[model samples]
Structure formats: C-alpha cells, structure tokens
Target chain A: MDEKVLLTGNIAAAEGALYAGCRHYFGYPITPQSDVVEYFSAKLPQMGGEFVQSESECTSINMLYGAAACGIRAMTSTSSPGFSLMQEGISHIAAAELPCVIMHVQRGGPGSGSTQTAQMDYNQVVKGGGHGEYRLIVLAPDSVQEIFDFVQLGFYLAEKYRNPALVLTDAIIGQMKEDVELRTIDFGPTPEDRSWALKIHRSPKGKSANVHSAVGIVGIYNEWLARTNEKYENIKRDEVRFQSMFMEDAELAIVAYGSSGRAAKGACKLAREEGLKVGVLRPITLWPFPQPQIEELASRVKKILVVEDNLGQMVEDVRGAVEGRAEVHFMGVFSRHMPDCNGMIFPDTILEEVKKLL
Target chain B: MSGEDERKLICDTPDCINNTLLPTCPGCLHGVVARCVCEAIDDLGIQENAIGVVGVGCHAMTAGAVEVDTISTAHGRAPGVATGIKRAYYGEAIVFTFQGDGDLGAIGLGDVLNAVNRGEKLTTIFFNNAGYGNTGGQMGPTTIEGQVTTTSPYGRDPAQSGFPLHMAEMMASLRGCAYSARVGINNLKNYAGARKAVKAAFQKQMDNIGYGFVEFLCTCPPGWKKKPDEAFHWMEKAMMEEYQLGEFKNVDEIT
Candidate 1:
C-alpha cells in the first residue's frame, strides 16, 4: 500500500532504503545527513534489522563493504568531509564488485568548508571519487519524493551491475519538507546467491569467496578494465535519463539537475510568459548523463544555458554533450567555501540569464 | 620392504594442511605461523565453520592456505572488516583475523582497539615480525630500538622512530579483552608453546569468550637481512628479550 505523508528528503531517503530491503545501516554523524543516521538507527532495529553508529566514516563504509560482500543489503550516509573519508573503502568495494548504496548529502568544501547545501560534488559522485578505474551509478534527485524514490533505484542499479550506487543530494533537497507517497518495494535475490558473494553459509564442500581489489596489479587490472568498460558502455547506452518541459517548440534549452533543475523549471515558465520560448532539461542520472536528449535539444534549440550552484562543473559535460551543435552558456555562482543561504540558483536569477541570451 | 612398515602411511580426519605447496619464501616464519593457525583450527574441529579476515603484507598470503571461508581485507582494515563479519553473523560463525605488526599496530590501531573495546567475539593472530615484510623491510611500529630496516637503515632510534609498541600488553589493559598473550617461534621448544597459545586463543573464541589475541614473535629472514639460522638466533637473543613470552590476560582474571 502506498501512503501519503509529509517527510524531509533525508527521512524520505531513509524510509525508502528500508522499504527497498536495506537490512544493515552503518554511518557516522555528519551535518545535513545526520537525520538519515538517526532515522535508520531507530527504525532499522525496530524492524528487526541492524544499525551501527560507526566510529568514523572509514569504518562505516568498510562495514557496509563487509555486509555487502555477504550479499546483504546495506547502506551508509554522509556529508562531504565524512564522505571524503569513505573514498578508500569505496574503491575497495568497487574493485571487489560488491553491491551497496552510499548517500552523500552535498555540503560546501575543499576541506571542512560548510554544512550548507551545495551541488559542487557533481564530479566527485559521477566520476570516480576514489583511485583506479571504477564507476558508481549516481542518481540526482530534485524533490523530497524523488529522493525517497531514487534510493530504491540506487540499490537496484547497484545490484544489477554488481557495483556501488550513490544518491547525490544537497542541503536544500535534503532539509526541505514535502508531501510524499511512500511505497514498499520487494527486493531481489541476495548477491551471494548469484555465486559471486562471500558465501555466508559455509560448508566443507563449498568454495571460499576471494574478494580483493588488486589495486596495482597491472595484468589483472587490464582484465578488470575490459569488463568494467563494457558494463559502463552498456549503462551509457541504456541508463541515460532526463525530463524536459516546454521543449516542444522552444528556441533555448536550460540545462540543470537536482534543486537547480527545480529552479530552472520555474525560470522556463517565466521566460515563456515573457515570450522567450525557454525550456528545461533536467538530468536524473548524472553519469550515463542524458547526452542523447541534450543532442536532440541542441539541434532544435538555438542556445543552451547550463545553471548550477557550483563554479561551473557540470557545464563541461553539458558542453561535451552539445558538442558545438548549439552555443552553450554557463551561469554558475561561486561560493567562498562557505554556506550559501541564498546562493542557490533561483528562478528570477536563471530567468535573468535566459533573458540576456534572448 | 616390510608390509607392516608400508601400512604405517595413513592420512585421515583433520585434513589440516592445504594440498597446494607452501607458498612462502624459504625459511620465512610466515609459513610456520600459517601452519600453526591451520593446525589450531583443525585441532578445534571448527575448520568448516571458521571465517578468516586477512590483512595486507605477507600476512595476506595466509588466506590462500587457510581452508576456511576467507576474505582479504584492505591494508590495515582487517579488524574493521572482521568486526562487521562477526556482527553480521554473530554467534553463528567463528571469525578470526590474521595480521602483521604494520597492519595491526601502525595504521590500524584504532580498528583493533574499538573492536576489542566493543568486546567482539573474535580471535586475532598477530605476527610481530618487526618490519613490513612485503614492502622490503620498512620500519613498523613493532620495529625494535637499534634494529635496522629499510626506512631505519641507521638503526631504529627511540627518539626518531618511537619505542616499539607492545600490543599484547596494550590489549591486556583493555577490560573487554578476555585473553592476550605474547609467544615466539624460534626454537623447537618455543614452537610447542606457541602452538599451545594459538590453540588457547581459538578455543576462547569457540567458547564465546570475548576478544582473544595472540602476538607471535616470528622471524623475517630477508627483512632482517640475515640467513635463516641467523634470524632464529636473533629472535632468541634480541626479540625474545624485548617481547616476553607469557599470557598477559586470562578470562578468569579479567572478566
């Protein structure tokens, strides 16, 4: 049964993960993401699951790795600094091809910058944040409901590919409350049943599971590269997801994702009322990025405006996706590694940029 | 050949050693340590139910020879991994960690301490070979004063490198630790005691006792830049002098 309720993005994500069959939750407290840890800590145990308040983000990620290696559905959540500490474990889990979900509620930083919401981690989440050639199935959710919904999808993609999945949201989306419809989903087989997981039910005759990253083995890495590359190519071909509005006959396409995309939706309506024919293209998956849809819009639209809260990170990918098919303009507001209460891209601000291009 | 003598060759029951040839350099104590651990698991009759979490360095190779379900953890993260495994399968499986001094003492001290403090029911077999054997004898936390290593070619200075950490003594101080012992493997006499200590550590975990640890003062011939026989003599003379072989904590006294 689906029930309607008011929930914050952080709470929604936790509830969604629970419904998706995440039985093990491990995390350390980080601002903007602490609600997730708190929620899971209380709720998971009540539901006959396990929760561990880890000593550090490094420990939490490795705990998730250990649980996932045994084919258990596990997760961990963090903000920037804590998430940064998890990179080493993430690399190990990826190399071992374990399935797990990690949530990073974006914060401002090169170091311990701010606990405020920001979209600066686009590269860190989509590209490999850790060492070696690895890819995480990254989902960017704009609304509280989507944040709830995408967690289930994140786990699915992780298990589907036997790799890690990340739910990348920022402070605004994570903290903001909204009415959401929560539905319980049935989770699939444990990864251990598929013959790759570390067999938990050990018998004398069963084969022992050998899981390692082989981080610097040149010969072994080539084989890993070939297999991972093929999987990523298939993901690129099948998983590129985007949503567009007012694109039916618009002359300009506004590109954004997550909260910025929500702001762009409002800007598109404002531009259309002023007879500017602006449309919005919001990407749902940051990696396997909505390239083909951007290509289609590039052919139809005369110009593209890419807006973000970061100092022009995703615009590079947008430009590459467009590939000179249209003139791409980047409109990003840079912050001083501090929280931006009003630094988020607003509808008026994006409209102003679109009007300038018009 | 007498028929009675031919019938004396019998191999049965506790198939302790793996069929594969020992995969260690000649005269390395890693082989001896591996044999002792496998023998302990066999002696306890928990080989089928045991799970091994192995750390990096030469100790990582021990997993291949271990007949149990084994997972090689990241360098210095075996205790953390073992903690997760033990918690996930709590009271269902026997979990153990095989780690070297560099993996347990240097970068991974926190993981071991926290797990022990939480009183995780797992056995830890610590190999204090004094230096990082896999990385060509670099200085480690257990590297003794006045000892020569790749990073401390001028000999380990108490001022520069800090005093060698006695992990068995440190772990013994923790209230959560049910048992902690330091044993050496140099002479035939010490080997017998070392086997007893290893067996006791495993038996404690089997009894659902908390956080048992056995620190083995083993030899690294190449790391020490000595011949096999010379390494044994040095272990007897210097290493044993610094790391006393005795049980520091027993469950009957601690808990």
Candidate 2:
C-alpha cells in the first residue's frame, strides 16, 4: 500500500497506469483529458517510460495499436470529438483483439461540441465505438479512487481477454479533484497469460506468418472481425461487473454508472429514508452490461430506475434485460446540468410512488 | 495515386532506397525521402528502436512501407504523433515523422510548431512538395505563389490566398528547435544536401539534442500537371524563392 494522495481523476488514472507498469501512452492534447497527457509526459520519461502527445486522436490510437502489437501495455485518453476521431482505430483494436487502454472523459456531441461534460456519447461507447461488431470493456468511474480502480481493472481485463478497454467518464468526474487511495492490486498481464497477443510476434511456429489487419483478398476480413466479436461475446460472459444494493428484497432498482451512479446512490438513500424499497445496479464494467444480474434482479424487483446524464442510452439496456418483467423508469439530466444527486427526486417528487409501494 | 492509402508509390526515384523492398510502384521522390530518413536513422543505429509516425496525404501512403514500428496519423498530425512516440518511448530509439505540405503546413501546423517549440527530442522530415498530390493537385499551404492546382484553377493569386507557408523558416523562429533546414530531392545538388541535413537532424536527436526539422522542397509532377522532368525544373524555379536554403536554427550555435 502506498500513501494516499489527493489527485484529480486524470492524474489518478495516470497513476493507475504507472502502477500497472504501463510505460507507453499516446495522446493528443484535447481538453479535459489533457491532464492525463500532461501528467505522464513529464513523469514517464523520469521512470524510463513512453509518453507521447499525439497529433490527433487518430494518430494516438494508431500509436497505441503499434505499441500493443509489440505486446506492451499502452494507453490514450481523449474527450468527445477527439474520441470520435478515435472510433476508426478503436474498431481496429477491437477487431484485432489487441490489449490496450483508452480513456474518454466524454463531452457534448456531434461536431466540435463544448469541451465540457456530457453523456451523449453513451451510445457510441457501449454500442461499439468505431464500426463492425465489437464492444470495448467500458468502465465508468465516478470518483478519483474508482478512476484508479477502473484503470487498473481496464488493463487487467484488456489483457485478460486480449481486447481494448475504455474508461468512460464525464467531464465532471475527470476535472473534479478528490482523494485517491494508492492501493496496489493484481494488475499485470503475465507472459504466460497473454500468449495470444503479438508481443513476441509468435507467428504460429514460423509458418511464414503474415500478421495484418487487412480484410483478406478473400472474405477472411469479415471472419476475422467475427472472431473479435465472438471474443467480446465470451468476454461479456466472464467480465460483467456491477454492484446491486437492496435489489434482493426491493421493488425498484436504479441502473446507473459513473457520475450518474453517484447521484443514483443519493436517490437510493433518500428512497430508503422514505421507506421505499429502492436498490441500485452500479456497473463497474460497462460492456458486459451485467445483463444477467439485471435480469435476475428484474425477476423479483417490480421496477427498474435508470439514472444517467444522457437522454436514454443505458436505460435501453436496463429495459432490454427486464424485457417488461419489471416496470423500467429513467432519471436523466443532460450532461450539462449535474444530476440533482442532492435527492431532488426522492421522498418528495416520487414520494407518491414510494408510498404506494411501501 | 499519390494519396493517403499508399494509393501511389515513389520508389522509382533515382538512388531511392527501399527498406521494405516489397512489390509496389511509388512516386519517384517518395523512395528518395524514405531512404534518406531510414538511412539517417540507421546511420544512428536506430533501425530496430526507431519509430516512424506517418501523416495523411502522400506521406501516409508509406504506412506499412518500412519494417520498423509505425503509427499512421491523420493529415498534418505527424509531428504530434512523433512527439508522443519520443516522449513515451524515450531512449528506446529515434522518433521521426514523414509528412507532406498539407499534413505539416496546413492541418497539422500547430502540432509541428509546438513540438519544435517544446523542443521535444524528435526529428521531423517535412516534405514541402508544393501541391497536394493526391487530391487532384489541390492547393496546399506550401503551394508557391501563382502556382495552379485543382483548387486554384487560374493559378494562385496573393489576394485570394496568402503567401505560401515556410515551415523551415517558421520553425527556425522557435528557440526550442535544435536544427531546421530546407532541402530538396529532385535536383542532384540539393539531394545530397538534403541527405546531409536529414542525417544531421536525426543525429541531433540521437545525441539527445532537442527538436530537429528538415523541410524538403521536392517535386510532384502528376499533381503539378507537368512532365516529370519539368517537375524538377519547377522545383528549382518556383519553390526556392521565399524558402531559402540554410540552417534556420541550431542549438549548438548557442555555445
């Protein structure tokens, strides 16, 4: 265990990468996420590591691709527009089933959106960032400690499954500062473990290997893509992460993650004070959407409340898991206005529903 | 075919060295710059450790051309990507960029400038071949005054478009920059000079000196709507006006 330090989410993530022995970081200076680049740019060389402020998100991802191909742990971070620029490379990484980490402190949408926070890119993250059939091992970290935890987890799972991992947080969580507990954890990719990665260029016993991401002259490209998708499916099976509170004996559950999950926790506390049976499913890993957990909870719970900063992204997943088994509701505040986590919708506005249930 | 996708090749240029030696036809000057940079890196014995960041435009066409680890970036972003490579993988080996006028001068200009200003220990080979070769000979920031391309059908005018950008002169203004010189490939006289300047740039980095940039005033015949021989003459008559040949900055001079 190391001494605890007050750190920003960006610095916390950088520390986690450093702790995990990730020596390579490729990124461009995009707002909100710049701290991640700034921290490592100075610190990495001191530790004999690699820190690159790439020219664009596109180049950043490609650089990570190069490093990951060498079987080394590499990472990059960006916001909305920059992240979108990364979509193409993200898809390639997912398709190649390479091990790497990317952080997206999300901002508002479309083109050149404000360099501020927004959950508008929710659909982009969980639904497959670039193209083809794939999903990043997405983690929405709310606190500085969780940023550390999730970055560690992101690296662990990425190498564990030989896939890309994304730490998806909003500007609120990224820019905000808090105490980050510096606790060491099992966060390394063992050599025996990552046999599938191309670090050693283990081209199948010298069969004159042609390692390429190109779609084959034949249709192997699609099949190759399908292989990565299949890995995502398998990873989802083993990698689903979420925390369920009071769902076992409750009538309603809040499905949320990251900053939105923080607000949902407050809402749950108030709902409990009002004597309403409310629980929450806060996802630690997003791609493996904890579908089975939500499905199991829905079997007993009467309703599901999805709280998110976006309009209706994660709620759809909650509803899909419920499949009308439970009444699914939503709590959304655009990425602009922070969720009224101060119990804005509990015991007072939704008191009638809680009272009726109680 | 001088496009972003390695759509064209430049390997046929005289005395051009092909590192990949794969089967493809490249633009004549493409192989020249590639060989120059690779030789500089090899002369410093960084072949195994050096990483090349390629930008969009024709230079990006060389994505997988070299055997070394490479990162292909968006247009004009080679310098920034190179910055990332050297910063993260410091002391592993040399880090350099191969970029065209469009990528370096126009789109990725900020990255190139700040990378030099920050004086990051990376080498940049800015290919200042005036016209944007791939996109139907479009006007690039480095396109000379009165030069005609797809965008400027009636030839370039001072009022309609500002003066062509001078990357070497501009980058020379930064104190962080260790070395910068404008060189060329189409001519025998400047080609040797270009090779020397390129080697110096990489040597500056290998010696842990700061940032180094080499801008080559090369030729693009197909893009310039001229015969291949005429392209070299055009390189001589047009590009050398404002972008004079000389060392823009040398950190060693401070001593």
lDDT of 2 at B210: 79
Local accuracy by lDDT, each model: 0.84, 0.72
Docking class of 1: medium
Per-residue error (Å), model 1, residue B99: 1.1
Q: What is candidate 2's DockQ?
A: 0.12
What TM-score would each prediction reach against the true structure?
0.94, 0.79
Q: What is the lDDT of residue A303 in candidate 2?
A: 72
Sorted into a CAPRI-style docking class, model 2 comes out as: incorrect
Residue-level lDDT tens digits of model 1 in A197-315: 55555676767666676645412767788888898999889877788899998898999999899999999998889888888999999988888888878889889999888888999
C-alpha RMSD of each candidate structure in angstroms:
2.5, 7.0
- lDDT by residue (A240-337, candidate 2, tens digit) is 77777767667777787887777677767788886777887898877878888888888887877676665778888888888999888775653223
Worst 10-residue lDDT window, candidate 1 chain B: B11-20
